[model samples]
Target chain A: MTDMYDFFNFILQIRNFVIHLQCSITLIHNNNMIEIKNLSFGYLKGHWVFNDLNLTVEQGGIYGLLGPNGQGKSTLLYLISGLLRPNEGEVTMNGTSTGLRLPSILSKIFIVPEEFTLPAITMKEYCQLNAPFYPKFSFDELSENLKAFGLDTDINMASFSMGQKKKAFLSFALACNTEILLLDEPTNGLDVTGKADFRRFIASHMNDNRTIIISTHQIHDVEKLLDHIIILGKNGLPVIDSPVSLIANKLCFEMIANGATPSQNEIFSKPTFGGNNIVSIRTDESPETEINLEMLYELAAEKPSEIKQILLNN
Target chain B: MRNNITQDKFLWSRLWMHIKREILSNMKQIRWQLALIVGVVLISEILICSNAYDNWKQNDYFYNSAFQDPAQLPILLAMVALGLFIVAIAASMTFSSLRTKAGKINQLMSVGTSAEKFWTRVLIYGVAPALFFLTSVCIIDLIRCVLVDSIMPIKAQFVIINPFIDETRVKAILLFCSFTACVSSFFTTVSVYSPKHAFLKGVCIIIALQTLGSWFLFRYGNILRPWEYHLDLAYWTALGVLTAIAVVLSVVSYIKYKETEL
Candidate 1:
């Protein structure tokens, strides 16, 4: 009986070792992406902005981080970029803790904060001073981006207006060619034409190795450019975090023409100019439509668990 | 350039580039500071020269008596004090780039290790100011002395002030240099600990530390009498304590710099 007990114990130890090995391998596989695990943070003590939050961002997609005010959308980006630290757990990029601020990690990441102060120097000098740090910085690309934004490289940044400054900075940031780019309120100061240019710049620069996460309240400005959407709910919990393609497959967004009856599968609706916009469960007969960001946000805000269940069921 | 991986390991090339970036980025502010230093020193020295000439013209023997020593001790002391003042200001502004939220993000996100950034500030803000102060003040004094001698009718024996004129003066110079270094490092650490209004905070902390130290010494004077019996031991002990303090402050500054968050 003693021999039998020892044999079982040895087998259990082997099983545990195998499980641990598999976990290690999974971590190695996840090294190429950004991972946030069990992260809790707050500006003040005992007033938690996020509690036990977990997220994973992969490469090759433009992700929109959306939520209401004070939901920690901007704070989350800062945490990922190493501008802030978590009270618990970790945020890692390429298998390294971002909070460490290692040069290896810093060189690969760039963040365009909502409000920034550009030095009182000409754009040419600015590039000369800052571009050497990122080995992949491209002057040609910078010129092209600046041209797209209708800016000149010789202009003095000190004299530019806030909108112009944002454009110049956005041009430079995209030209840096970093692996991960975090943009907060990128279109806040841009004009209508500039906003369209901004979208074009983003769409043209994206590549398979790059991951851009944009946090903005201007959902209409980014809806067309996004391939993934992660919406945060109250207390900084994710209401829905999924690819746009998956969201489109499980749900249908449409404009119900005037005098038409509401569909039986409707989940949420909002009144509009000519008709009512609706988000509903996708059915066999439902024609595919582009995702309506405003309607989708309302649904996620009003019926978070219902949407989560629908996304999970399929 | 193509996408490449960077390492946290110390590299001479990277440090050199980081230092260059710091200088170029702050070139405008540095130029203004340089102008201010030169302007203040020039105006003060000229005033002193003019006042001496007026005194000599009115009372020949009286002015000669006062100006006998070409290397005036008080003037040398004044120059050292000015240098320390410059060092204090420069050191206090070492982390000025971290003052604003945007500036803090730009600096912290720059591609360099924390050690590289810390040492760069120490060299630019702490060491460079002291060197510039020494060189510029000495040259200015030389010019002032020569110009005054040529313009005055009487040979007043006006010459450049030298800190190494005698043994006592040399020792005094050494003491002042050590004090200046300690002050510079203290302000450097203060900049890291308090980036906003760092100069004001540093001054307050210095005044507080001096008062506390004096009080501690007075309170424990009787208990420390044994050290007085062995002067050599006391001297070495004091030196060791100072060296340890400097090292600890530097290490603490580096650690604090590394852990800074927005």
Candidate 2:
């Protein structure tokens, strides 16, 4: 009996060793494109913008970075792009720290800032000069983007209005074909038609190898395009999940009449023009409805722990 | 060894690409403004030279003595001033993009190593502009000589030969070049640190340096005279110190730029 007990203990040890080995291998080949560990950043000392924040963005798909006005949505993007360094902790891309900014790493990322000034040159000239840095840049795709945006390649960028310039820049950025694209408030200066064009342009350009993270307070602009959503709060990230998982596992977004009583499961409700938009827990096996991003963002910000617990429990 | 070589080749290629992009972007943004400024300077210099040539022609005694072995004082002074002015402009605008928040983001986020970006800016705004200024001075002087020769019977030519050939003038030219380089490097360093009003701060520092140097010279004029101490040694010492400062400033600037956050 003693020998049998020893044998079973040995088998248990072997099982533990195999599990550890598998975990090591997964870490070595970490598929997540970006990982932020214990990130603490602030513009001024003693006034923390992000406090001990941690986030992991997987490879591929468009991610909507939503937050309140001063919750560091833009700052987070800047840190990931290596434009702003975190006070503590680090931002890594595929297990490499972005702060190092190696040529190999830099070539794989592009950033489109909210307010950027283009050189006073034609779009063709700009591309000719700047495109060579990005190894995967495609002139054919640039041409297609220009055509789609109704912009002539030969037109001087200095003459372009703000909206036109943004369109042209967005087109160029998409054509650069970097693995990671970080856009901060990209649709701010865009018109209604320009925003639609922007959406189409982004959707057409996305590939399995590419990941685009757009940080914006305007959730409606990017709601339909997002595969994953990250809603930041005053302290840390409260929500980091795909739309499908969000709709299926945690919350049910519904539009009810103005005078109708909300169900007991309804966690949050907001008044809309025609009725009240309500977010409740998913109970039955019915097909998930489309998520209301605005409502989701509000619930996440105001009652993060409640929403977090529901998500975790589900 | 083979992998290392391939990596080096890739790095060099990327550096070259960045340099080309910087040059093209600068040309697009500032070409017309640069042209206008250069045109104005050239015209003004031509006018001044023509007037001096007329004076030399009118005064036979002054013309005969100066022309016998032209002093080249005015030409030398013009060249020195032109070199300083060109370097000042280049240094002032080298890292101007850092002044604006948007420009800083655009610049720092671009694809390239920090070292590569530093060298690109130095090549575009420091070395290239200085060389262009030197070439312009030589060409303008040649043109002035030709104009004088065409107009006057008495020939007074501003020789276009290399300054290194003249043992007497070599030290002066070298000193001038070194001073210009030092100033340029210093201002470039200032641009990296001072985000706003960089040009103004740089000019103020230069003025302060000049005042201090003048005071030092005045205070020790008798003790440090050419008769007591070897003038060549002093000149060489000053050049060495200035060159050291310039190199140190450039290295510091590059390191600061690498760590700069927008």
Candidate 3:
């Protein structure tokens, strides 16, 4: 009996190993799904929001785009999604220029803007009208997402409160199941419980063949789910690195008592109600800890050169 | 080449889907307004028919002698002409939502090509409303004729003029359609560029065009209307020019739509 159990366990382990290998292969195949090549864009002729910006977002994992107000985080997403044209350079998806907006290419991208107008129709009708455009749209996923948000697909969308409408729109956006999902300020109107559910839903929906880009100034809302964070400076240049690398290489975030003296390695600090939250360069003896995205954003905004050197070296 | 063909097929399918969606949404949005318009027009037509029938019954010989010829029904002609204005208004309303920043973002982010969006608006706002208006008019006229025939003792006959049956009526209809086509296309093009108050802009454009046209005619009327000037040739030339302008405007609208930025 023991020998037979061992053999069955071995067989199960082999099967699991094969499944893991397949997932990795699929991820490798979709690497570098979005490539932004020297993109320059601005709403006006003489002014530019992003100048000669280059970015590559690979498939799989959620990317948190962090920036202060007016840093053009949302604009970058729009340019990538082809909603706005770049003044110079191009954004390509799977080696095809997104400017063309070919039907097949559009089918793979979905964007949930910070502000939008849902037609005066029921959620069901809205989905019926739009779902056909995306070949991979999943009705089951839509139902699940709506239920998670405490919404019903049959409700009239026009009657929904702002938060409820955002929830409904986000549900539909995720249900589209496009390979690339661009979300701008997705957690803006969500309540506490709703925000938690939003994060959970995004985490559950992630797959090896998909990429999700979320742009928001509210860093804490999405900090936990982000595998990589791209912080855009006021000048539009971005410092892209993984949260793990950021914590391990350059900074160690800590909460000390208010009025504590600054340490030699302290890079930045901000006083909080209970304590002084601090960002300092990681020393040989300093242990790695959670990254405070808010501090990082503030530090990067104030001294982009210093942060850029650290991030680039890593 | 094979890949190009496949891409084109995909785009066409998506365009058809977009057109159907726009048609359904527009119908839902304007159904009540359309019903109200039809009701008002039908009631007015009924009253007019009733008065005409009463006059005919009072003096059958005089009515027959004065206006019994089978010319195009003036009321129908007038209604068709009014329908063109309605079409222009509808065309201007097509992209009214684009006036708002939120609405513009929603539209640009939606999964459809610029060509698909442009053509869908053209069909829904420019073509479909005109056809609907004409159909409503015909139905109202038929009801009017029935009521007049049944209520009058003199049995007044209201001849429903079919434009296709007579050459002159056909030409008049062709000219009217050409004019409507030009006006509707112009409004559609205006809607693409004027993000806010597109209808107002369209009205201003129409006023400007009319003023220019009047000035031209006033200045060159004598020179163009000499004894040898053929009116038919003038009409045809006008039609050709208007059609050319409409085509050019539509192409410009498409190009502008394709290059639109949020």
Candidate 4:
């Protein structure tokens, strides 16, 4: 019986080793794209924006950077894109530290900011002037993009409307063909059709070698497209993970139109239409209920520590 | 290994595409600014030309005394416009989308482009305008001088038409622009730091400095460049110091951008 117990103990130890090994491998590989550890940022001194954040995004797919207003959504994107430096942490890309400017790293990343201005030139002139910076910038692809936008390559972008301008920026960003693309408020001025087109563009363009992080208040614009979602807490670090898997195993989102208090099924509950609460439950399976991003965001925002607990449990 | 393929593009090249589209999409805006700038230049030119023509046509010193040397009129005209464009680009670049130079710096900084690249963009966008305006004023003044000479009996052929520039003056212009642009690049860091009308802030800073400089001059006797603003020597030592300071500040700003989370 003693020998048998030792044999069983050995087997358990081996199993644990394998699991740890796999996790370590995943963690190491995550650094291939972007890596952040113990990151703390704040605009003003002693007033923190985010603190003790740890995150990793592997090469490829789309990351939805979700947060409430005044939360660090755009700030985080800017930090990762090497636009803004973090006050208390390190951000590394492709094994290179971002504290120093590496053209190799910079050339690989492209950011389409919330607001951008184009110069006074024809669309073709714009292309002619800006296409050579990125090694992957495809004139042919840019032309195709222009066609898709119903834009004449020869025409001036100055003639475009706000929506058209945004569309043009999206197309141009895609055309740059960088490995990492950071988009802030990409759907701001776009119409429903334009938004749909953007979804399609994201879906079609996402490649294994490419990673995209889009920051927006409107999570619906990116919910379907994101493979991972990194939700930032005001004055808190981040919890980054695959959205579907997170929703399935860690939390369940459901809308309740008649709840007055904490339902037995709810880990978190918020009011919905006609006095209903969009309640979230701790679950181990995909919730067949509706995906209400607003509610999910509220849960994440209102209870970051709780969300962290859920993440820890997962 | 085959899974994660990445390619690079030149930032300026990519920026140019956006620039082209922007220019195309906002032709009316540009047209308006252009019309305003050009109108101001032409109207000023006409006033000077008319005065000079009257002075020469009258061939009367008593009546022409108000006209003060038609030959020198272009220089005066250029000085007035210099002041105008400075104010204009500041407000235009900051307040409106007309001057996208500061915005581009912020964007470039966000994208992690180097300080060198950032400055290059500014030079093309910011100093390029200044240079263009400088040359234009010189050319316009030279043309005015020719016209004034044709009309006036007082033909002083060697009246420094582009009085603000020369061999020695080029050094000053280069140093001045370098100093100003280094200062202006603060707009990028400031805009990123605050994230509100960053462009406007950049413009305000410049305008405030100019106004302060003028006030200082008015209060005192001589012009005040403010905080080592001038290249006093136009000598190699001063030039070297200016270049080094410009480089350090720009690089420092770029470094500052490295930490700025947009």
Runs off by more than 4 Å, candidate 1: A1-32, B1-5, B52-59, B62-67, B153-170, B217-238
Off by over 4 Å in 4: A1-31, A99-101, A120-122, A139-155, A239-243, A250-295, A301-307, B1-106, B109-113, B125-156, B161-262
Candidate 4 lDDT, A196-302, residue by residue in tens: 88898888888898899888987888878887777776565664345656665656666545735555656676555676555556544544654566776777778
* TM-score for all models, in order of appearance: 0.90, 0.88, 0.87, 0.65
lDDT of 3 by residue, A1-314 (tens): 99997888788568546644654564467677888989888888868899899888987878999887898988888888887888899998877677767665677888898888777778888888888877778999999999989997777777999999999999999998899999999999999999999999999999988899999977888988888888887658885445555655678898899667776788888888888888888887988878788888888877778877776664
Residue A237 accuracy (lDDT) in model 4? 61
Q: Over all chains combined, what TM-score does candidate 4 have?
A: 0.65
Interface quality of candidate 1 as DockQ = 0.33
lDDT of 1 at A149: 84
Instruction: Give the i-RMS of model 3 in Å.
Output: 9.3
TM-score of chain A of 4: 0.82
Model 2 reproduces what portion of true contacts? 0.47
- Which model scores highest in TM-score? 1
lDDT of 3 by residue, B112-187 (tens): 6677777777776677777777778777776665664565434433444567777887887778777777888788
Q: Point out the higher-scoring one by TM-score: 1 or 3.
A: 1
Error of 2 at A270 (Å): 2.1
Write model 2 residue lDDT over B12-80, tens digit each, in one string: 666677777777776755566456546745775666666666666667655356544242456666666
lDDT of 1 by residue, B1-262 (tens): 2232365555567778778878887789888888888887777666666665665566665445654633344456567668788999999998888888898898899888888888888898888877877777777877766765676554444333366678655654555656677778788899998888988999998899889989999998787889889976776566566656767887888898889999
Give lDDT per model, in order. Answer: 0.84, 0.78, 0.77, 0.63
Tens digits of per-residue lDDT for model 4, B1-262: 1111111223444444445544454566656654555556556666766765575567766465644565464646455445445533532242132134436434453332444444444444445445555555556667766775675555533333343656766765665555555555455445434445666666687789899988887898444345345445435665577567656755665565444333
Off by over 4 Å in 3: A1-30, A239-244, A258-262, B1-12, B24-27, B50-74, B153-160, B226-228
Candidate 3 deviation (Cα RMSD)? 10.5
Model 3 — TM-score against the truth? Answer: 0.87
